[model samples]
Target: MAQFYSAKRRVTTRQIITVNVTDLDPFGQGVARHEGKALFVPGLLPGETGEVTLTEEKRQFARGAVKKRLSDSPERVPPRCPHFGVCGGCQQQHASVSLQQQSKSQALSRLMKRDVDEVIAGPEWGYRRRARLSLAFSPRDQTLQMGFRKASSNELVDVHQCPILAPRLEALLAPLRACLSELETIRNPGHVELVLADNGPLLVLRHLAPLSAADRQKLERFSHSEGVALYLAAQSDTLEQVSGEAPWYTSDQLRLSFSPRDFIQVNDAVNQQMVARALTWLSVEPGERVLDLFCGMGNFTLPLAKRAQSVVGVEGVAALVAKGDYNARLNSLKNVTFFHENLEEDVTRQPWAKAGFDKVLLDPARAGAAGVMHHIVKLLPKRVVYVSCNPTTLARDSDALLAAGYQIRRLAMLDMFPHTGHLESMVLFVRE
Candidate 1:
């Protein structure tokens, strides 16, 4: 018998296929079924038909780019930013704000298995108070390119003006780019962070190499001319203030002083409203002891202290814990205390956990508080508020509370990031 070799099948990466979008995913991608697999098409809206070219293919699903739309949805609207489709900062700019929120709300509701009781929103544009722009130097052009990363790629898209940024920060982009382009030792710059604090605008430049004296003076001059606080980050952990005072933002009548690298909510107006709403839903009593988990820089802890008998804030980052303490002192909040501990581990053994809390409030990261959900149950707090930035994790963590006989008293969708796919929410769980 002769041995014969057969040619292997070839799979084409790019194939145009007509798709009828039945729904929109949480990330603003259109949902359609193509050849028994879920097809995700960008820039396509629900109730729209489009020709999509498959860009990525996997066993269970596929992602594609919209080649041509056969039909359009009434809810679709024009994106405001010039860099809307290219920039990765926002995903739902093409859709109307109402449509985006509705899609996100439906997705969240399906995951949580409950109807969202309320929706809290703020200004759609000019709401971002903080943003970090990527910096790269093109060797061919001998010019510094400053902008955000392209969607799902490392390539940077040069952004002239960001409509979502605060007015003051947006205005500084051109001049700041000009100033950075003139710097000598900033060829291999890391990134530039622009923050509009309550006091003033702040600029933090991350430089991999040491800056020369002349470059420092130039930066100082630019900072003075723009009246923006400038900080130079020579290392990941250190920041040297080249000009201006420390930055702080006010919330709940308390001043929170934070370093430039600290994690603060990007939206100022929504954050203020979120804090107020969280407080209102928590309903902290004057004589009740409260616990705030994953509390960074006392965003919620200090406010709870004003109403509660005493409030304890537990944070993982030591720097944020220190800032929390500092902010507590700055606000003259004597009833609150800050503790630095890894919340992922068993925090029930900590001194702060020993004293039982009447109520608990947790504002966790996108990962949610899987590690602390069980611990919160053991504490037997009468009421618990969970502030989540990721709905999947929130739903997973909510199981623990529900299993422990806690009922969701209130659930509200927080539109912290208007145009982005980031779905923030808060839920109040009352022990039955």
Candidate 2:
């Protein structure tokens, strides 16, 4: 079969080349040009002259890895993590903090075609409140490797500690590995979710098979000794809270409870700032109706309710919708309600969709809200605030809103994921 043979063609006379990087791409790779062909090298920064081993050749561009650096950029700094170059968790660790922000703002500005109004910065280190530690049994070594995946590869990095995680969570890495090692019954354990909730650290062990009583006793002992919450998710859609109090967090005059499996912002400080800025930009007024799409656990819905006459939160997940309802009642906000509606589908006929919201807030996932943007425009909301985790989708959606007679009023880039090439942005669009 044609597929049996390698699609790649081998090129002879390929040799290492020294190139001077001129710019950095969104993925934090250095951009270099040689013989009129573009080259991309990882761990190489702009204004740096580096030796690269050309790994692949394509029609237009080439890909390589930095072998040695002849000259370094002024913005280049030593990465704090020992596994910086290897771990996929962080990509821009070699760039200075200010440089990292500058690059991100530049990339976002170029995509949006508008000057960024503000840059919301947060703690440079130990700011991650939650993380998913990969688990794999290495038969070759007869040991378990618990850490993040290698950069551009599926192999585990076996990190002893992660500097980006909260201090409380970082302290549990060794202990977690030791605990897993002690559990003989846990063959092929899935993954461990570490959460640094406002209450404390919560450890969620996801397993493919059932745990033995002896294994449960050992986990219970570990949880008690460590004074952290523990949960088991043997089956999807089911979480058994084994021990400890429920974890919760407060933001923008509202408190919300969450489980380890629930989706929450990774950076707490930036989240607070983002929520505050979103409310400020929207400028919700009394007697005004607000609609929050993809409202997860009322993160923005509850806060928006404080200043508006009424707020309706829409989410696809029934569990999150229930959580939002509980949060509204927990905060004693009678004007707020939540509904379960698949945003990807046509929601124009839903009862809540006819509420005639004056303002709209969207915090969609990485796919962005293209599927709902046109329908939302039909509502004729005076102001729309879109929070995006992916810039490419945001750019595409911006075009959609512009076509619908909405003008970009303000834009801010949030460094929610510092030290990584990932970017988060908030855009305010007003009727033209």
Candidate 3:
């Protein structure tokens, strides 16, 4: 049994005080200083005096919720989403668009210390290209449920109309609910991860156990009747399709083919823009060689191959590499090569890893490439484009890059997951 209480861990009631939010942390929480201690405040605006009831406090920092507003910021606005605070989907719903963009842009500015004027903005509403809604049953009675979790508790938020999802995807929710109601063995179908490909929206339903024959038929019927794709998740970080014919989606300029189970960018509009900007920043030459790290299915490699003499994409998953090779063959690009390399572990393997490329692009996860940056810099590429979701980790890695005699050239912010405090940024580094 879990401990209900601990003497040292017990939270103490602190005086409610309003403080001006200064910045945002990696987790999308607002950062404010109170009585010389840092407090992670949610639902706050910078330059706004908001009162907070400290919930958990460490020696250096604290976490708290909004208590009262002694003074409100000029940029704070009414949240359009009905599930703003209740749902954990977006942390910056109440924050103004300009304010959020500034917060996001400042992250890049502070980290790279480079001028970032070209901000990529997209449709603020109905722009989410992908999402994962969780499943949970009501504790009081056996009531089937599907939605995201609330910000305050483990309880489901019961998201019905997500304004951030594309209209096509938003319209499919009702039909999906009806389809799920007919499934006999879907009592605990807790998560429905939806992805909008160029082909159509794909739904990956996550159940606690395997499905029966009847349940499989029901999914096929739903997929055909609703004219949408269907998928299933056997476990966390895993995905598979329930039906035989999985759908494919694409962009006008590029044809990106992948499964819902695979990792794809969440925002389609912003992703297209991100890919373009990454290539523009790369500025590959006719004779230049390029290497794309963490290149899932050639999102960057395919584009780079079009410009460079040769392009190499390395990923941890062999399936993606094979799929990437398929993608290259489909596009008839013969110069692009896909390789499976554990970047985090084999950063210093020299030619055994990645040979010297004129340019490189690394799109790493939140954990950052701290483990590999030092060893990987041995290639001494003329230019590098680093895409990061966490600014703190980006800063730590940037410090390493700077130590390797690299100078920050450009930094730009992308409002990929808008209405959320989470900031996404990309940087260009040049060897001096």
Off by over 4 Å in 2: 1-13, 139-141
List the candidates' TM-scores in order.
Answer: 0.95, 0.95, 0.88
- In every candidate, how many clashes are there? 0, 0, 5
Candidate with maximal lDDT:
1
**Ranking of candidates on lDDT, top first:** 1, 2, 3
Q: Write candidate 3's Cα lDDT for 1-432 as tens digits.
A: 343455456465766866788776544567898768888888776776787888887777788888887777777788887888888888887777777787778666767666676678799999987888776655467555767888757888877789999988888877777777677765656678787877777788878878888888888898888777777777876777665455544533657677677778778788888989888888999999888988888888898988999988888899899888988887888999888888877554646344578998999888888877886577888899999888878888988789989988888888888887677888889999
Q: Per-residue lDDT tens digits of candidate 1, residues 64-95?
A: 89899999799988889999988999999888
Record all residue pairs in model 2 with backbone atoms less than 3 Å apart, i.e. clashing.
Answer: none
Model 1: weakest 10-residue lDDT segment is 3-12
For candidate 1, give the lDDT: 0.90
Query: Which residue pairs come into collision in candidate 1?
Result: none
- Estimate, for each residue in 199-314, the C-alpha lDDT of model 2 and write its tens digit: 88999998887898988999999999998899999987689999999998997868898877889999999999999999998999998999999998999999999999999999
Residue 422 lDDT, candidate 1, scale 0-100: 89
Judge candidate 3 against the unseen true structure and give its global Cα lDDT, from 0 to 1.
Answer: 0.79
* Model 3: how far residue 375 lies from native, Å: 3.5
- The parts of candidate 1 lying over 4 Å away from their true place are 1-13
